[model samples]
Target chain A: MLDVTKAKIIHDFAHDRPLLACRYDPKERFVVTSSEDYRLQKFSLPGGEKTILPEAHNSWVHALGLSPDGQILYSGGCDGKLVFWNIADAEVKPLRTLDAHQGWLRTLSVSPDGSLVATGGNDKTVKVWNTQTGELVKQWQGHAKNVYSVQFMPDGKRILSGDLGGAVQLRSLDADDIKGNFEAKPLHTYEGGQMVDFGGVRCLAVRPSSDQFAAGGLHKATNPLGAVHEPLALRFAFEGNQLLKSHVSEGITGGGLWRVQWLSDGTLMGVSGGSSGGFLIFWNDQQDKDFSKFKLPALARDMDLSTNGLNVVTAHHDGHVRITRLSES
Target chain B: MKCPYACGSTEHLMARRKFLSLSASGAVGVAGGLGLLTRGAAAEQVQQKQQRIVVFNMHGGLSQLESWDPKPGTRTGGPFRAIPTSVPGLHISELLPYTAQQMHHLCLFRGVNTSEDDHGKGAYMMMTGRRQTPAADYPEIGAVAAKTLMPEDSSLPGHIRVVPHGGGGRGSDAAYLGPKYSSIHLGNGNPPQYTKRPDGITDEAERRRQEFRRKSDRRFLDGRRTAMTDVFTYSFEQADRLMEQRDVFDVTKEPTQDQEKYGTHDFGRHCLLARRLIERGISFVQVSHSNYDTHNENFDFHLEQVGEFDRPFATFVADLAERGLLDQTLIVVLSEFGRTPNINLYLGRDHWSKAWSVLAGGAKLARGAVLGATNAEGTEVVDIQVDHAQLFHTYLQAVGVDTSASFQIDGRELPIADPSAEPIWTAIA
Candidate 1:
């Protein structure tokens, strides 16, 4: 068994405000953090040297996506603008800007080939853009609420988008349309009877093999406004959109999981927190038992896995970026 | 001096007391020119005019940051941005896009410092314009409007509440203003209960039954006078009147195009019903939108609730203007308080009353006026802090009520508004 409790925080980068989104470069030598201070900072791993993009976005940046090659960075902000940046030799350069969304852009996902980027936004839209050209390729509108998370399937032929109403849609990319315009079909939805009106699917992770995906968010909604609720992860089979299994972290209750990631070894991890504090939970599909969990210092807003698959970095609401080592027992 | 309406006998004294109670209720001279000696000539003139008030109560403390007083780009501003409205240089939250377009008919009060915080207490304070007190129960603004502005000859209930059962805070009772002024509670988007005859009961049979009951009640009250019995008698009469005009509460009578414009949700339908009831001469209508107490996922819930509220409210306001009722109707958008500017660990906002906002307009209120101001973080009132009582006073004043007038209850006279409070003069035309 791998014990996360023994994981040590190797480095902590502090900012003036909460860091909302973060990404690890493919080389695993650089990390980019987006903050509420409206700046994006690129920090050299291990060295702690930082390069700041002061005017990265007009408002708070909530989402960031790194190209498959890791040379390009894309950020979406509350200003409804998406900007592309080129990171080379520990320096940041502004490349292009797309006034794509009408409202706050929530999440961004880049294709494996780095040809396209899909964005989910508060405007209830899932938009696809050409990664190289800053042009909006396709706009799909089926979600009745804010689309919180979007991910491109490993095959790159389909995109999965989840919304605040606990609805998920699988949209197939049209090969014939050069503009990337495609129809979105309802693939799967899971309300879990947890007040679909309030909570949503916050995070989605696709397996490396592209056979299945896991979604993490709140279930078992409560009253008194913000009272503790269970954080859940539902794993679905990619082909049939069948719900294969659900893993709920027992005894760890409060807010919904904000981020979910599938480790190279097929282990699933989720980070969540509420009034009490933050928590890191781990689950393996083969195990029928409870998840292994660890407490954190603050609410985790975003997380990224190192390219080496040995360390996990989390951006916290307390303005600390925590890097934790992961190893097998 | 002997009472002109009654002789100097014990029964006559009781009858005179009833007249005093009627005058104290503020309903006696609402439509007539019967000027009481206690009322100033100007106050009498104000009371003689017919006006209406419709309070759109966002039940949970709506975040000021997401509505009327947006501080976009601030650290505490959350994920939403500010959008410019019809009034140049004035911006509200982007979530209220529809309301933004109708800002010319609204006056925004961004610096309300109501000190109460708990749901029940805060709701009481906002509804009554006074803090919760064990000493006495004060009437809500709707009840006061019903008592002071409702025409005596009008068949419709003066104060109508469109809310889900057990919603709308502690229920808008008349309190000391007496039962006659209490709100006629209607189900959310549905008519008041029992307004229609029972399934098996014919209308003729129902009328005959009511007539028989009135005769029996008269005999039961033979030569005896009590406020409790009078309330019962008044309730029966009001029920009869409501039954006669039940169609006023039927929103289905509205055209499908109009209903579609309202968006078809419960809150939307309730707003549509409110407009219909107001058109039928109801003096005060309160429509409540629920589930704004978003301590968890504040942004998501606000997007849903505010989105649900925006279009219908804008459509309602615009519809009133097109019907020429805007000049006579005062529209109020309020809540018990506001949510905290500081997003909590759950990414939600908690109850915050230290600084908040309320929106009022129409009935000749200054259009495109943004009164008062909050600090950049929206944490405190930096200028022209208006409290609950002051807001209540403004609502009454906007609808042509005399704030200086007093309501006499139990021989104790009380000013209609808190004496220490004053209306926001900048908001008044």
Candidate 2:
């Protein structure tokens, strides 16, 4: 079980601007964060040593994806530019920058083999890039609105993309025999909730076994303007893209889940907050109820879990990177 | 005298004289004679090319940082950036890219100090140009324009409000100016009820029915001379005039290309209708865009709301300019107030009134002009602060109304604007 009764903040690092995206190095020795100040910084875990890479993007850097080998990182910003970074050096170095999208890039996902990087953007297109060569591999146009999140299934031949209209589509990455060229075919689609018109799926997590995936976002807008709704986390069986279950934090007043992740032991976690406050909630497969939850000082924009699953770090709108510890089973 | 409708027949004049004789009374006799005299006066007013006003009321407070005045890169600026407009140094939020292209036609006021924060009170103050008082009711700007600028023989109601979602708050009434100047509220892109003749009724039959009803109503109203009775009598006459030219409210009369340019959303259609009404010589047209409260998820909701607003508004302005109405029509974009500059814990902004922004253009108002300034954090006005009364006076002046005039309400002279306030002269030509 996930225990938050003994949860404690391990470290808190401040940046010049709100940190929007974060990723943990494969060895778990460092954490790289992107911020609205257009800078990316690397912080050494435990020691808290910070190295800032100036001018990382022309505008707010919103999405960060790290290679499986931890040797390279990809950053996408509102300037519509996507850049590849070589993080093996003492300082992060830009390998190449590609004018990827026509609008703000919201989410990025790397294939399991690290050969392809999938990007979702405000242009309403899902684009795959050759990570090493910095070339455009494929682009799929199916989302009716801004594409918010994309993820590669563990099998690495299929992708899941979500949009502002709350549509989740499973697409094939391989070329069809009749087409003779790589064209993403929509395999399945899941409509999140009646409130899908109010918001889109913001974060998606595929299980380690690739048999199930969870999508998180707001379930409804209580008012016409404010997104004061229940933060919803839906778990779906991959076989048919069937919705198996849904979870929400009881008594939580306001906010929508901005990020979701599945722990190695199958604990599903969601981070969300709005004007009332922020929350970090965890749910296990055995029950629909949240097993544990911790409140944060500010809204958590994004989060990354360490490989061992003992530590989870969150980037916040208040310019603080909060590190918290989970009880070991 | 020539008939206003130019039907080249004396039948309309005979009908007017007959209606006047039926309702003639000691109290209404003077009003009837003055009304006839004003018809000639109205021709003179029209000869001067009477200016018109269109108030785009953003019902709930819109965020100044997201629309007119942006403090990008600040802690409270959210994720959107500020982009340069056609004006050299003026910058507005990137969310309004389409409006930005039309900046040369707009004058932005970023330093407004409306002290009331509550929705009802703020709306009252902004609409009536005066603080709430227990002594007397105040006239809204639309009502004032209806009384002061509309041609006496206008077939359409001078003051009209197109409320799509619903009414925002109080203060749309004519108050002391009486119900005759009150706004004619229309539903979401639909014509006012009873406008169309019933399926089985012929035009001549309908006219005969109206004449019979008017004769009975005049008899019933002969001794009952109250404000309520006057309002009822006025409504009947207005409805009769409206039936003759109801096509002005038919937005479908516009071509498909024009409709597509304004977009298909309710707000867009309302704007297109506002343009049509203005073209038909409406004195004041208030089109309200609802639900900008945005107490949480400010940036996300703004992207949706502003994205929907930008294209239609920009297109409307451009169309007005292309049709040569820009010089004679005054366009006002306003809200009750603005949202707080402090980004709340919910990632939203609460209601704020101390410092905000409003956009005005046309009627020879200074173009490409940005007046006033807010502090670095947008928490307070730093330069040339304008209050609700001053802004209202400026609007009146832009539309060629005498801001210094007063209305004789209940035997007391009430100033059109706040007595102590002056127009923002720098904003007007």
Question: Which digits, one per residue and each the tens of the lDDT, describe model 1 over residues B165-236?
Answer: 432212438776666677877866677777677789887888799779867876776666355555566667
Residues A138-159, candidate 2, lDDT per residue (tens digit)? 8888777888889888888778
Interface RMSD of each: 3.4, 4.4
Looking only at chain B, model 1 earns a TM-score of: 0.89
Error of 2 at A46 (Å): 0.9
Top model number, DockQ: 1
The residue ranges of model 2 lying beyond 4 angstroms of the native Cα positions read A1-7, A175-197, A224-227, A296-298, B1-47, B166-172
Report the interface RMSD that candidate 1 achieves against the true structure, in angstroms: 3.4
What's the true lDDT of residue A129 in model 1?
95
Task: Return the clash pairs for model 1, or none.
Answer: none
**Cα lDDT tens digits for candidate 1, A97-119:** 88878778889999989999999
The CAPRI class of candidate 1 is acceptable
Every model's Cα RMSD, please? Answer: 4.9, 6.1
Clashing pairs in 2: A274-B346, A275-B345, A275-B346
